[model samples]
Target: MWNGDGTVEVYGFRVFYSEVDCVRRIFEKYPETATNIRPKNQMVKNAYMNNLLDLIDIICLAPQELTEEELRNAESQLLELVEVGFKLDWLKNKLEELCVKKKKMEARGARMRELDGLIMEQRRVLWELETELKNEENEAVSDSARLGFEDVV
Candidate 1:
């Protein structure tokens, strides 16, 4: 089934099968659990279907696939589980990393907001100071001119 984002979920496994022929061939070749097996009970086939459903559930609950950094270390694990493997640990670790990153990003965003507020406050204070300075200079010039200092020019 298409996952709506160009990804396909075949036999409950998310496979990046873009072409139809490759997907069809994989299904046709692996007909046991890969095809012709409904997730729901189909008569006495319920036993097999139940087992398949459990496997799918395990896969879904399992950790994400290995990253490029861990791919070498996970090769053997992946090979062992080709037919039965679920990367639960990898998925869990990735999720934890994501959570940590998200928290850091949120903290950074909050800090930036605080800095913005401080900058705005500073701007307001600077504007008031400049206005006061300008008024004081104007008054000084007017007072000097009124005190018969006009000829001093």
Candidate 2:
């Protein structure tokens, strides 16, 4: 349970043991970390806290105002992650499934387009064949008329 008062010394965010140790060390080293609790997870909840801390430490050590701003944002985001408390594994799995489904739909669409093109070509050939047959019938009729006139003469 978090005390509704904004002391922020202890994070209500759930973190793993690895994070606890790294955070414990950071808390001991930095007064800000001790008072402001943001749970930074590295890989898993506890395992990756140190990696995030390391990035923060680098940014803090750098000589730029923007770096300070980035550090603040990172800290805030870490706290927000804890507050949201969505499972990372579940999100990863959902993303993978979505990617697979999208790829399959794309392939199906491509195949349908290919089939449509083939159908159009077949239709064109059939129309050309019908036109040729009509021309041949007209030629045969004219030949027969000429022969009948010659017979009359």
Candidate 3:
């Protein structure tokens, strides 16, 4: 419904002049028949369908705009809109970014596993060296005791 100012309410969402001009054309085509709301509503829907990408751009690509919560809201809207057959041209870019991030995380995980294996091997080698040193000390003490006993005899 035309609000008599410069806006039309379409499906509970208000469409303003700044956002789209197609709905305004419907007003111009049927200026005197505001009472006949069906045509206007249909035209509003057509306008929305034609400008779906523009809506996505506002919700997803607005510059320096939308807070974290707002971004989440936009994400929800985008998902809903896509379910309704809305297509986004920039989705390929987002997919590429996510793939690159996944690769980086996998590389980091591999590096961590390698470091852990090296640390375990180093600890094992150190324990073996300590055991050998103790064995050598015990042998030296036993040999010295045998020499003392022989001298005593």
Task: Find the candidate with the highest TM-score and give its number.
Answer: 1
CA lDDT scores, all candidates in order: 0.50, 0.50, 0.55
**1-153: candidate 1 lDDT, tens digit per residue:** 776766565555544455445545534654543333333433333343334333333334323343433433344433333334322344344445544555566689799999999999999999999999999999998887754567666
* Candidate 3 lDDT by residue in tens digits, 1-153: 667777666443367756556545534553431332233455555454444444445544433344455445555655554554434335434533444555566688799999999999999999999999999999988887755666888
- lDDT for model 3, please: 0.55
Best by lDDT: 3
Residue 78 shift from truth in candidate 2, angstroms: 14
Q: If the candidates were sorted by their lDDT against the true structure, best first, what order would they fall in? A: 3, 1, 2
* TM-scores of the models, in the order given: 0.44, 0.40, 0.39
Shift of residue 60 alpha carbon in model 1, Å: 16
Lowest-sum lDDT 10-residue window in model 1: 78-87
Residue ranges of candidate 1 with Cα displaced over 4 Å:
1-16, 19-85, 146-153
Q: What does each candidate score in C-alpha RMSD?
A: 11.7, 15.0, 11.4
